[model samples]
Target: MSDKILIIDDEPGIRSSLRGILEDEGFNVQAVASGEEGLALIKRENFDVILLDIWLEGLDGLEVLKKLKEEEEKAQVIMITGHGSVETAVRAIKQGAYDFLEKPLSLEKVVVTVKNALHQKKLEEENLILRSKFRNKYQKLVGESPVIKELKKKIAKAAASKASVVIYGESGTGKELVARLIHQQSSRKNKKFIHINLAAIPEHLLPRELFGYIKGAFPEAASDKKGKVLLANGGTLFLDEIGEINPLLQIKLLHLLEKGIIEPEGSLEPIPVDVRIIATSQVNLAPLVRAKRFRDDLFFKINVLPIVIPPLRERKEDIPLLIDYYLDYFSLELGKKKKTMTSAAKKAFLNYSWPGNISELINVIERFVIMVPEDEIRPEHLSLLVEPRELQLTPQNNHILSLKEAILHFEKEYIHRRLMTNGWEVKRTAQELKVTPQELKEKIRSLGIRIAD
Candidate 1:
């Protein structure tokens, strides 16, 4: 669609000239005789840009501009005048005119100014969309399981205090989601929420990445940089996979926790930071701390407000609700009609152990919504389950092992296949095998099975 331009001028010649020039440039131009007509059009329709003359019949251009400002209008307005002066331009700008143009307006200048204004409007619109998405992602925690309800109650309490939080959960168990929820619900909701994954950063580059450096701080420190702590000042900093951080950095981090201050590389001055810390770990930190891999004192400092999220298997009742939620979400996202699962299909999903958790379920839902042409998802549609069950063993191979060995081998293979199908969600896989999650973990360890990425 072409850009919409509104021309409000008293002179017939000026209106005609602008209309011709703008239309030729592929704009949808509408020329009005006075400010009243322009205001009426603005109320009824949307325009990308408006050209208003300073002198109009009933209401002057400045008055119209003031009214637009009061109404919180979004279009970019350029003031047009035959008697242009520094004072008039300044007044027009203060009244919310994007730019001012005198009579004998240059066609080139008009086009350039309009383009710049449009660009600025586009950026603002994009920012609004990003913020909306950010809000929607952390606005609420999904599911109605008892554990989920308990977590919500704890989150409210945690948000009320300024103490550092340490969230413990397995992979794909919504640890980061909980962190974001805390930030969204806390008083720092309007401020930045910076996240850094300790596991993702290389050991050699960890210091530079966490505590940014000044120019020539190191061989590769080309210019000055602001670290996550400084960037998250007056906000929250999420340190994901905190156990993966090396011991040296842990000491420095402990100091930062004691006194909300940071000294950038090659700088001696301490820069105070008012940042809230939210850390997450997938493994038990106590074991690592016992092994001297993680600092004990540092652990105590961050463990002030601890939150532990149970794996999905422990809350099996929420599976159906999660499935329905993902189905609706994916259907809308993929622009397809919402699909329903057959009772048998739902049962198959319910029985299967989900090794991957909610993230894995979402991927499966997206695949079914997009790939399956039928509106109903049946048991046959679940290839992850049906296909794996088809694996067979020959009598010649079966005779090689004792009954006990054959059972162990079968159990190991069955559990491994289910884990792969569910993206390695141990709790879900355990439920499928009719074994405790701890039993499945031990079996996986005993059988020497390595999960594929």
Candidate 2:
């Protein structure tokens, strides 16, 4: 659609000429004789640009500009006058006029100014959209528990430093959330925040994904591409599941950390980068280092400011707050009326050991919002999460099983029992095990336990 232009001038000839010029330039133009008519038209319709003569029959241009500023009208206003002065132009600009024009206006100058003003407005809109997206993705870390409070304090401290951070937590424990919180509070918050999950990316493609590649680097490389490391320059690079990266990739990452340079595939020249690294892992890197699976140097490098997010089981007191948050969030999202849970349902949630942490709880709440038709969620709506059974060690099995084998067997039986007790509801069984539903499903797979009768 063409930009809408409103011309407010006392002189009929000036309004007619301005409308003709703007309309011919592919603008939808409307001419008004006074500021009163202009403001009335503005109230009824949206205009991209307004041309107002300073001296009008009633409600002068400056007065209309003040009203527009007060009302927060987004249209760009240009002040036109035969007797234009430097002081008058400055005052009009201060009053939110996009530009000031002298009488006997040059049509070319008018078109250029309007174009620039529209371009500025477009940029402002784009910026607002980007900031809104950033806020949604990097929402404030919720929870007021002691553990959460401590983590917030530590995040504040870490934000002031340039040290590499490593967040340790189980799957679904908000490791990436912590990283984003740190980045948001840091000085580089306005820059990019690039995230890469090492475990998700294939091993053969990992290097090019991190360091980028040049044109003709491989058979599929038709054009040069920028990778996460380069795209994250002067910002933060979040490496999730850092321990899953292979040793060869570890060496490349270590080189980048030590040298602040990346050699893209098929490029000999090393490009300098100024990226802050924030790595997270579900398992302890120390064991991986000791077992010779991960590099000790790399471990030391990323573990500079280690932050451990406690599991939901450890911070069970925050479960209700999380439940309420998800309930309200999903209700609004799903366009459903707010649903309250019965005391028994609440108790069931509190008693259940959440293995997947906040992530699991969010999924459960979302499911309840969609499936639970009642205004109130009752005990039956909740999954049965009985107490986890104790590991049984029979004398016959103890003699044959190694410690690792015995623990594996016990875990298999424990998960199987929970699944059966919960009537094969994966979410409930996972909560009972204090693990995510996905994690529980993985265990069922590895143990070869079939839920089918």
Candidate 3:
């Protein structure tokens, strides 16, 4: 569609001339006789640019501009007048006018200004789209369970403040993901977000890596270097696995957290930093503090806002949703056809204990997208990757059971396994067990076996 331009002026000759020029420039031009008419037209239609004369019959151009600002109109406005002055141009610009033009307007300048305004508008729109995409990528938590909902609330409240945050979760439970979400929603989102894993860095060189030294400070110090603290000034610094830091490093970190000052390993002067600390730990710091392995002061300083992420096994109800999300995600990412899982396969997934948590689940789905060739994934395909926990009577438990109770337990397990293999189809399972469908249904009800939808 061609760009739409609105020409608002009282003089018939000026409106006609402006309309002709804009139309010749391949723009869809609409000319109006008064500001009131232009405002009414804007209410019904949208335009890319508005050319408004300063002097109108009832409502002046400035007043119309004020109304547009109140409505938050997206179109760019340019001011035109026969009697123009520097003061008028500055005021118009302050009021959000794209440009100010005199009565003897240069048609060439008009085209250039309008094109520039359009370009600026396009860039602003693209910027908004990119920011939205970035937000969705980092801010999504992908679960609707009660625990997850509460966790999101905590993250939002924590993001609004500048206090230090400490996240607690098991490995593969997305601790760093929560930290990134907090930073993305904070006031300093436009600034840097620096992350360093304490567990990944070597203990012998951690000090130099964190608090960089000046040139000639050491034999290998070739030039002045900025540490993570200094580099993350006015932004956020995420310390992953903060519990892994040694005792000496913990003391230095405590001093920095207390004074907001960082002293390089060999530097004489201490530089103050303005960094928001976000730390994560798989282990509880309180026990470590009691054991004298972690400094109490440092632990307290970084634990102002605490957030805990629940593991996948605890939220089994949300497993189906997570499976669907990852299946679609990996299919699109790998440019493969999305596959469906058989009832047996889904039952297997629900039966397994996800000890590795969401990270493990995501990897498993991605692997299926790349390796599984069939459109319908079955239990055998999944068994290649992980063995689903099955119902069994162990020797220890069997010893405590009566003879009749043991026989009933074995019967239940056998029926349940057969039903699952046949995708919960009663007739097929009954045929395999040499019984009628009605009898099989009665046995299922007596054994209290839950069927998967």
Taking all chains together, each candidate's TM-score versus the true structure is 0.61, 0.59, 0.57
- The 10 consecutive residues of candidate 1 with the worst lDDT sum are 385-394
Q: What tens digits encode model 3's per-residue C-alpha lDDT throughout 278-380?
A: 9999988899999999888888898999899999888877777877887777777678999877667776677655667888777777777777898778866
Model 2 C-alpha lDDT per residue in residues 1-453, reported as the tens digit of each score: 466789999899898888888888899899999888888656545567899888888798899999989777777898897763657767899878988889788999888988888887767755864676554522657788999999999999889999999999998888988998898789887566889999998999999999988778899998667778977777899999999999999999999999999988988778877889999989989999999999999988889999999998888788778777777778886899998776666666676556667777777787888878889987666432221222234545437878888788778766765665555567887887798978877887777653211
Candidate 3, residue 381: Cα displacement in angstroms equals 1.9
Question: For residue 213, what is the lDDT in candidate 2?
Answer: 83
lDDT pick, better of 2 and 3: 2
Give lDDT tens digits, candidate 1, residues 249-319. Answer: 99989999998778888876777667899999988899999999999999999989999998877887888
Give me the runs in candidate 2 sitting further than 4 Å from their true place. 1-138, 383-453
Which candidate number would show the highest lDDT if scored against the true structure?
2
RMSD of 1: 14.8
The candidate, 1 or 3, that scores higher on TM-score is 1
For candidate 1, the lDDT comes to 0.79
